[model samples]
Target: MAKILVVDDEAHIRELIRLYLVDEGFEVIEKANGEDALAYAENQSVDLAIIDIMMPKLDGWDLCKELRELDEMPILMVTSKGEAQDKIKGFKLGTDDYLVKPFDPVELVLRVKALLKRYRIDASSLIKLGSIMLDRRTYQVIYKDGNQVTIPMKEFELLYKLGSYTNQLFTRDHLIEQIWGMDYEGDERTVDVHIKRLRERFAEFESDFKIVTIRGLGYRLEVYRD
Candidate 1:
């Protein structure tokens, strides 16, 4: 069973999440404050974390930052503030998803399951193409020359998709669906932007592969043979 850490200051809120999560066959670990949650996360193997922003001691934002540094598991932020800035802040802090207060229990469970599914999809945690080593666990890329490059979430997913299948063409719409999701409102140009960013980042190191653009089709990873 997957272990989930539930952090909230209110007893009822914690209990409510526990009931829903437990029903979904997940093992829930409850914490009353961010301090306890952070400590527990440090010492235990947690698959996912459901954090409330208005907790005592360490706030959700700080706690999320700390936990992200410690683990690569998915994190979902729960907050009463529904403002766009607040959600952006949570995303900037490395939260995978966000939930508003008064959310449906069923929706919460579904979101949690989806996150777990996404994280567990990769059979190999580390994928190597040419001289580039992509660590799926931490999303860090290491070059053969010992230089480490950090990639953003979307860019990293795009690179992983292409790198995992060297020389396979991926259409713009296909990449959009795979990385940005089916509900993405952005145009195909979003793929172009991410691809550009990936190319620039890879250029910083002496990489043996390059992301090639296919005219009128999409892109692929081209690896140079030794």
Candidate 2:
């Protein structure tokens, strides 16, 4: 069963979220303030977290920053502010998604469902392309006969995105936006560097998966036969 931690200052809202989450067959834990929520998030084995932005101890943004340092579990922020800046801040902090106050319980559950679906796919730990396997969680890629290739996280994120969306042409900006996020302040050419590194690793490991650059566009992952 998935464990969900809900943090909301208002007792009613917390209860409402907890009820729906529990009814959805998830194990739900509730906290009333960001302080306690941060503590549990830092120490406990929570699969997902829903934090209220406006809280007494620590605001949702601070809590999110602190928690993200320790865990990458999906975090859904609930706020009443309804500002684009606030939403951007949440996403920039690596939050999976955000919601505003006066939210529908069903919609909340739906977000949770969508988040969990992506989480499950990500947590699979194995990215299979024909006979090649890339494990993001373990940072390992093995050939069909079990040869190993080592790839770093940024490279892995890039390769994972490529292999996940095989044959889809993504420009440098698009790759930066999806892989790095909109608020990321980095050079667009960094994508080229990572791609160069990825190709080197793939060649050295003699893997059948290759990343191809689309001249005026960007790169993609295709089977060696492609």
Candidate 3:
């Protein structure tokens, strides 16, 4: 489901938009004004944002500008006023689409869906580490020597990230922040535990297939083919 940020002062408008988007299979996040919208955008991942122009603290143009600086997520500026200057300002601030108020709710939904479809991502479809193969879409981990492991959520993510980058080492502190979010509430030792479990799981294939520890630096996946 696509995550959408709806920034509007009117509670009725927020509810109206949320209802419409949710019906269309979107995950809607509602913010009453520009400041809270900005804060949400900085932390959460949003596929698209619908920003209203006449808002408290920071207006839509300024809010869009701030969001553009932080993330490349597509933005749609909505305003009651359909002035050319307002449209230009939003476009200059890097908004992907725009809608004027008193607009059709269906049109907004269509626009949101179209924007996401047009900007779809084709990220690396697969990640491989040693004899382990990770299928990005299916989220499957298979060993080359015939053993297979089906990982659950975070564990799968941790291994996939390590596999995706191959030989680049990442410290436990770094993995906690990167694989887990920066706001991860877990201890640093969580990385060590997961790595240990992963190593144990892979032991059926080869005792030497590497997730090497660099003493204090941390772990890297390295198995010499020679």
Candidate 4:
């Protein structure tokens, strides 16, 4: 059973989430504050985390960042704030998914399952998208025509990440943290530059997949289906 850490300031909210998750055969650990949640994660094994934005000690934003830095476990942010900017902030902080308040418990469970599945796919060293295959182990892009291209380390990683979760949106901040390390001091435009290079290098593979810029957001890989 996968262990889930649920951090919410409201007792009822935590209970509601726990009841539903436990029903799905998941092990749930409840924390009323981000500090306690972070402490638990550091000392224990957690497969995923459900965080609330408004908490007494160390809000969900910081907690999400801390957990992401700790490992690649998926994070789901549940908050009453439904504003677009707030959602963007959560994504930038590395939350894998988000849920607004008054959300159906069923939907929450579905999102949890989806995130787990997505992460499982991401764990693989090889990602096959349409006609192209990304070999993470060798940092090579193998085409259907038997042509292979090896790109820079950063470019390969960025492409691998996007292709791993095709059609999923990724904010620049999140990509920077995942590809460049949290301690990277370069500008966010570094992602833009690398993305441009990837586009140019794989321009002919448009039929297989394309990296799209979601204005004001970031980027997503779109794989064409036959």
Candidate 5:
């Protein structure tokens, strides 16, 4: 059973979420504040976390950042704020997904399941997208014809991260924080430059996978499957 940590300031809201999650066969740990939730996660094993943004002590934003720094567990942020900027901020903070208040419990469950699946796919060191194989251990890309190419470290890391979760959108800020260190004082265009090189390097492998530019957003890796 997957153990889920649910943090919210409201008692009734926590109970509602817990009831639905428990019914879906998930083991839930409910915390009324972010402080308690962070303490529990430090010592115990938690598969995922559901956080409310308006908590009293340590709001959801800070909690999400702290949790992400600790580990790679998927985080689902719940808040009444449905603004685009709020969502972007949450993504930048490393929250895997977001849900608005008064959301259907069924939709919440589905998002949780999808996030778990996506993370499971990303946890592998070796990701095979069609005939292109990314080996993180060696930082190499292997082609279908048994040809292997070792690219620049940053380019390889960027490619591997995208290929890990095909079709999942990643913001530029989020990518920078993940690939480069959080303290990186470089331009976001650095990601664009690396992405351009990856695209040029793998131009011949378009049939295998393509790094898609999501215009105002960022990017996602689309793998063509037979």
Candidate 6:
């Protein structure tokens, strides 16, 4: 059973989340504030974390920064503040996903599972294609000529999944399920956005492969050999 850490100031909210998480066969660890949550994280092997931003004693943002410094465990931010800036801040602090208040328990569970799946895939292997090398140990990509670029969490996972099986076509729905989770109710175009950003970022470096679209199917990483 995977262990999940839930941090919220409200007892009812914590219990609500716990009920659903436990029903899904996850071990639940609860904390009312970020202070306690941070302590628990340091001493425990938490697979994922759901944090409330408006808590007393070390808010979610601070705790997120602290935990991000320690490990790459997936972090999800839940709060009443649903502004774009808040979500962006959470992402910048290394949060894997953001859910606003009044969220559905089912959606929460889906996100949790999705994050765990993505994390497992990321930690499973190190991938190298031609001059580009993805080193999971350092969470970075290095080129044959020693040029290093640190990819964001989501982008890194996207690259890993695509590059893991070169020339294999992955449909958009499959990628969303594998990378974003089953309950991702967002637009499918989101995948295109991420892929475009990946291409743009890698364009600066020398890489032997490119992520290509399969015309109505999805995308694939095509490696061109010299």
Best by lDDT: 4
For all the candidates, what are their Cα RMSDs to the real structure?
13.6, 14.8, 11.9, 16.8, 16.3, 14.0
* Worst ten in a row by lDDT for model 3: 121-130
Runs of candidate 3 exceeding 4 Å displacement: 121-226
Q: Candidate 3 or 6, higher lDDT?
A: 6
Q: Tell me how candidate 6 scores on lDDT.
A: 0.87
Which prediction has the highest TM-score against the true structure? Answer: 3
Give me the overall lDDT of model 5: 0.89
TM agreement with the true structure for every prediction: 0.53, 0.52, 0.55, 0.53, 0.52, 0.53
Worst 10 residues of 1 by lDDT: 121-130
Let me know the TM-score candidate 1 reaches against the reference structure: 0.53
Cα lDDT computed for each candidate against the true fold: 0.86, 0.83, 0.80, 0.89, 0.89, 0.87
Per-residue lDDT of candidate 2, residues 1-226 (tens digit): 4788898899999899988988977789899888898888777878888998888989888888887777778899997855667887788788998888889999999999899888883333467876778877677777789987786888888888888788888899999998899998989899999999888876754456678878998887777642
Candidate 5 per-residue C-alpha lDDT over 1-226 given as tens digits, one digit per residue, 9 for 90 to 100: 4789999999998999999989987889999999999999999978899999988989888999999988889999998854667788888787888888888999999998898888873332568988888888679988779888899999999988998789999999999999998999999999999999999998987988899999999999999973
Per-residue lDDT tens digits of candidate 1, residues 101-200? 9889899999998998989832335678777788876788877888877889888999998987889999999898888889999788989988899889
> Please, what are the lDDT tens digits per residue for candidate 3 over residues 57-98?
988888888888888788887878647688777777778988
TM-score of 4: 0.53
Tell me the tens digit of each residue's lDDT in model 6 across 125-203: 3588667888766668987789878989788888888988989999999999999999999999989999999999888
- In the predicted model 1, the residue pairs found to clash are none
**Which window of 10 residues has the lowest lDDT sum in candidate 6?**
121-130
